[model samples]
Each structure stands twice: as C-alpha cells, then as structure tokens.
Target chain A: EDQVTQSPEALRLQEGESSSLNCSYTVSGLRGLFWYRQDPGKGPEFLFTLYSAGEEKEKERLKATLTKKESFLHITAPKPEDSATYLCAVQPGQGAQKLVFGQGTRLTINP
Target chain B: GAGVSQTPSNKVTEKGKYVELRCDPISGHTALYWYRQSLGQGPEFLIYFQGTGAADDSGLPNDRFFAVRPEGSVSTLKIQRTERGDSAVYLCASRMNSNTGELFFGEGSRLTVL
Candidate 1:
C-alpha cells in the first residue's frame, strides 16, 4: 500500500535557524509529490509539486527536493509568519486521482 | 469568491443525527473532491466528482457516507447516523483538470458529534 511518513512530528526553531523537514514515502508507482502549508483554523495552502527524482523547487524561504524514496522541505531563515504545519502528499500510479498524505510536521519559528 | 467555499463553518450535532456539508467550487472547475481530516492526521480522500458525476468514491468509509455534485458546480456531503468517530474537519477541494492538476481547498467545515 502507498504510505507517507513525515519526521520530527513537531519542531521548534529560532528565527533565522535553517532546518529541513523530511517526508518518506512508499508507493507502487510514483506520479507526483506535493507540499502544503496549513495554519490553524484554515485549509492547507499549496506549496510545491515534484514530479521526478532530483527535481527541486523553491519559493521565498522554502525549498523542496525530491528523490526516489523521500522528499525534503528546506526552510531557510524562516520567520514567525512561516510557522505552520507542513504536509507532504503523494499521488501514485498513472490513473490515480487521490493523494495520500503524511501526518505533517508542526513547525514553530520563534521570532 | 476567488477560492473554494464551504458552508456551516462549524457544526455540533448529536450522535445518530444526520448532517450535511456544502461546497461551492470556483467557477468553471470540472473536478471537485471531498476529504476528511482527523486530529493529528492528514486529510483522507472521501470522494471525487467530475461534471456532476461521481468518478471515484472508493475512499468513502461506508454506506453512511454519500456525496453528490449536481449541476457540476455545487457539491454536498451527506452523513447519516453520525457518530463521534465522524467528528473531523471535512474539506472540499476543486481543480480545473481532472488529471495532474493541483487542487485548491476551502477552509473546511468542522463537525463535532456528541
């Protein structure tokens, strides 16, 4: 079965402290991997979508990279406004329409 | 609205009662999806609709759960005999393309059954 696991269920970092959150996944046939940011009392906001191994995408202070077995979300010099739950989801197989998501990493940036 | 919209931002109902959640997608979106998110868990797919037809509903838990997207724009999720286990944030998302398109989500409706 396809599954996604995110590491460091919760993390606390000071402002300007760079760190990375990991998402390990097991899927029969990988199609796409997605990253989202969710704040309290709101729905998730889309971030990046990686389609193949060695693919990388960046937005502002966030950078995402993908490999065969895992993906990493690197946050550089994050501010207090960047604190949110980071989620990783994977779409498996060619004909699949659903995305299997990880539990997410709760990131706290102390300002 | 510029984004997907959900109604009844919060609902508190008794066990065994029925509940309905509504979603309005962005104009001209052909694909709509429903998901449930429990505490500390990722959102789980419940159903998907394409142009007023249910394309996939394998993620729905049981017979108590049903969803419909009539007129290909508005969708509603119906839950019968609600239980405490049904308490969660019901999310609605819409996308322009049926395949390989990113989904835009709404704020979601929080349902609490007691």
Candidate 2:
C-alpha cells in the first residue's frame, strides 16, 4: 500500500522560531508531493508541490523540499498566524488523481 | 466565487436520518473531489469525479454512501441512515483538468449525527 507518514504529531514553537516538518512516504512511483496548511474549522489551503528529489520551492516564510523517500516543510521565523496543521500528500504517477495524505503535524507558533 | 464552496456550514441530524452535502467547484475546474476528515486525522478520500462521471469511488466505506455530479459543475454526496460515526467535517476540492496537480479546497461542512 502507498503510505505517507508525518513526524512530530504536535509541535510548539516560539514566534520567529524556525523548524521543519517531515513527511516520509513509501510508494511505488513518485509523481508529486503536496503541502497544505489547515486551520481549525476550515479546509486545507494549498501551499506547494514537489515533483522530484532535490527539488525545492518556497513561498514567503514557508519552504518545501522533496527527497527520494521523504519531503520536508520548513518554516522560517514563523508567526502566530502561521499556526496550523500542516498536511502532506503524495500522488503517484499513474494519473489516478487521488492523493494519499499523512496524519498532519499540528504546529503552534506562540507569540 | 473564485474558490470552492460548500453549503450548510454545519449540519446536525439524527442517527437514522439521511443527509446530503453539496459542493460547488471553481469555474472551469473539471476535477472535483470529496474527502472526510475526522478529528486528529488526515482527510480520507471518498470519491473523485472528472466531468459528469465518477472517476473513482473506491474509498467509500459502504453502499450507503453515494455521490453525483450530473452536470459536472456541482456535486452532492448523499449518506443514508447516518450513524454517529459519520460525524465529521466533509471537505470538497477541485483542480484544473491539466496536470498542475494543485487542489483548491473549501471551508468544509461540519456534520454532527446524534
């Protein structure tokens, strides 16, 4: 089965702290990996997509990178508004259009 | 609206009642998806639709769950004989038919079965 696992189920960081959330996957083919941020009582918002190992993408205070077996979402100088559950999902190369998601990492940035 | 939209921000129903959740995809998005999210867990895929046909419905747990996208622009998920276990936030997402692989999600509908 294609599986995605995220580490550090819950993380607490001081404002302006920097840290990274990890998402490891075991899949037959690597198509694209996605990162999203979800707030309480709301749906997830898309962040970035990593398609290959050694590929990295950045937006504002968030950066996402992918490896052969895993992906990382790095937050630099996070603020209270950045507090949310970060989700990672993997889409295989078969054009299935279905995503296998990890149990998200709930991040809290304290001011 | 420019983003995906779901109706009835909150729904409360009895255990045996039937319920339907609606989703309006962003204009021109041909791929629509439905997912269920429980507390402390990731979203679980329920179904996927490309145009008016269902591309995948394998994630549905039982026969009581059904969905339709007759017109291809909006979709509805129907659940019969709802159980307390069915309570969760139902999310809807849509993406362009092209291979950008980016999904835009809505503010999910919270369902509570009593």
Candidate 3:
C-alpha cells in the first residue's frame, strides 16, 4: 500500500527562526512529490514538485529537498506571515492521476 | 474566474439527505480532481476527470459518492445519504495536464452533516 506520513504534527517557531518539516512516503514506484501551503479557511496553495532523489526546489524563504524515501521542507527565517499548514503529497508511477497526501504539519511563527 | 472555483462555500445538512457540490475548473484545463479533507487531516483523493471522462474514481469511499464532468469543464460531486462522517471540506483542483503533477486548488466547500 502507498502511504505518506508527515512528522512533527505541530511546530512553534519564533519569528526569524528556521526549521524543517519531514514527509516520508512509501509507494510502488515514485513518480512525483509535491509540497503545498494551506492557510486557514482556504485550500492548499502549490509550492514545489520534486521528481527524483537528490532533486531540490526553492521559492523565496522555502526550500524542498527529496530523497528515496523522504522529503524535507526547510523554512529559512520564517515570518509570521509564513505560518500555515504544510502539506506533502506523492504520485505513484502507475499512471493514475490521484495523489496520496500526508497529514500535514501545522506551523506557527510567533512574533 | 482565473482559477478553479467551487460553489456553496459552506453547506449544512442533516443525515440521510443528499447534497451536490460543484466545481468550475480554469478554462482549457483538461484534468480536474476532487478531494476530501477531514479536520486536521490532509486532503484525500476522491476522483479524477480527464476531459469529459472519469479517468479514475477509485478513491471514492463508496457508491454513495459520485462525481461527473459532462462538458469537461465543470464537475459536480453528489453525495447521497449524507452521514456525520461525510462532514468535511471538499476540495477541487485542476491542471493543464496529468504529467505536470502541479495542481491549482480552489477554496473548498465545507460540508457539515448533523
């Protein structure tokens, strides 16, 4: 069975603090890994997509790195505005368009 | 709108009642998807439509949950015999193609069954 797990269900960081969130996945064949940021009362906003191990992508203060079995979302000097639930999802290589998602990490940046 | 759109931002109904949720994907987008998000959990895949055909509906929990996209642009998710367990946020997303793997989501419709 394909599964995705995200660790540190919740995290609190002071403004300007940096942290990392983890996403571990088990799939038949790895196709793609995705990261999203979701704010309260809204749907997830797309962040990045990593297709292979050792692949990395960055946007603003966020960077995402991927491995064979895990992915990491690293936040650099996070601001209060950056507080949101970070979601990770994976697509298997079975040609299905469906994506399996992780529970997500709730992040809080206190000023 | 420029992005995907979902109707009935919030819905409250009683158990055993039927409900319909609508989604309008961006123009020219051929791949549309539906997902359900329970409280404090990630969105779970429900169904996927490629153009006017349902490419995959395996994620749907049961027969009571059905979705259709006739014109290939707008889709509707119909839930029959709504249960308290059916209460969740239904999300709709779209992409230009399936290979890209990046989906643009809409503000979901929050469904509450009591």
Candidate 4:
C-alpha cells in the first residue's frame, strides 16, 4: 500500500527560528514529490515539486529537498506570516493524476 | 491569472440532503481534480477529469458521490443522501497537464452535516 506520513504533527517556533518538517512515503514508483503551504481559511498554495532523488527547490525562506524514501521542508528565519500547515504529496506509478498526501505539519511561528 | 475558486465557501445541511459544490479552475488548465479533506488530515483524491472525460474515479467512496466537468473547465461535485461521515472540506485543483505535477487548489467548500 502507498502511504505518506508527516512527522511532528504540529510545531511551535519563535520568530526567526529555523526548523525542518519531514515527509516519509512508501510507494510503487515515485513520479514526483510536491510541497504546499496552506493558510487558515484558505486553500493550499503550491511551493515546489521535486522529480528525483537529490532534487531540491527553494522559494522565499522555504526550501524543499527530496530523496528516495522521504522529503524535507526546511524553513529559515520563519516569521509569523509563515505560519501555516505544510503539506507533502507524492505521485506514484502511472495511474491518474491522483496524489497521496501526508497528514501535514501545522506550524505556528510566534512573534 | 486568477487561481481556482470554489463556491459557497461553507455549507451546512442535514443528513440525507443533497448538496452540490462548484469549482472553477484556472483558465486553460486541462486537468481537474476533486479531493476530500477531513479534519486534521490531508486531502484524499476523489476523482480526476481530463478534459470532458473522467480519467479516474477510483478514489470516490461510493455511488453517492459524483463529479462532472462538462466543457473541460469548471467542475461540480455532487453528493446525494449525504451522511455525517461525508462532512468535510471538498477541494478542487487544476493542473496544466497530468505530467506537469503542479496542482493549483481552490479555497474549498466546507460541508457540515447536522
């Protein structure tokens, strides 16, 4: 069975603090790994897509890295505006465009 | 360009009532998808429409749920005889193509069953 699990379900950090969120997956064939940021009362916003192991992408203060079995979302000098739930999804095999997503990491950056 | 948008940001209905949720994807997006997200969980795939045809409906929970994208642009999700278990946020996303891999999502329509 294909599954994606995110760790530290929730995290609280002070402003300017840095941290990393983890997403582990088990799938047949990895097509791509994606990261998204979702704010309260709003839809998810696309962050990055990593297509292969050793691939990395960055936007603003967030960086996403991928490996064979997992992905990591690293936040640097995060601010309150960065507080949101971070989601990681994976596309497996060659089926439809269905994406299996992790539970998400609820991040709160306190100022 | 504007992002995906869902109608009736929130809906409250009694169990067994029928409800319709609308989703407007970004213009020119060829792939549309529907997903359901329960509290504290990630979105689960429900269906995917490539153009006017449903390329995949395997994730749909049962016959009570149906989705349609008539002109390959806007899509609607219909739920018949809704149960409390069906109460959740329905998300709509659109991508340029299946292989593009980047999905732009809508604010979602929140459904509450009483």
TM-score of chain A of each: 0.98, 0.97, 0.98, 0.96
User: lDDT for model 4, on a 0 to 1 scale?
Assistant: 0.92
The superposed Cα distance between candidate 3 and the true structure at residue A61, in angstroms, equals: 1.0
- Badly placed stretches (over 4 Å) of model 1 are none
Looking at model 2 chain B, which ten-residue stretch has the lowest summed lDDT?
Answer: B96-105
DockQ of 4: 0.84
DockQ of 1: 0.81
Model 1, span A61-103: residue lDDT tens: 9999999999999999999999999999998986888888899
> Deviation in angstroms for B15 in model 3?
1.2
User: Where is the poorest 10-residue window by lDDT in model 4 chain B?
Assistant: B95-104
- Model with the higher lDDT, candidate 2 or 3: 3
* Tens digit of per-residue lDDT, candidate 3, span B10-113: 99999999999999998999999999999999999999999999999999999999999999999999999999999999999999987666999999999999
Let me know the TM-score candidate 4 reaches against the reference structure: 0.97
Candidate 1: tens digits of C-alpha lDDT, residues B1-114:
899999999999999999999999989899999999998888999999989999999999999999988799999999999999999999999999678867899999999999
lDDT of 2 at A102: 96
lDDT of 2: 0.93
Residue A93, model 2: Cα distance from true site in angstroms = 1.6
Q: lDDT for model 3, please.
A: 0.95
The alpha-carbon lDDT assigned to residue B22 of candidate 2 equals 97
True contacts kept of each: 0.69, 0.71, 0.82, 0.87
Residues A13-82 of candidate 2: C-alpha lDDT, one tens digit per residue:
9999999999999987878999999999999999999999999999999999999999999999999999
DockQ of each: 0.81, 0.74, 0.84, 0.84
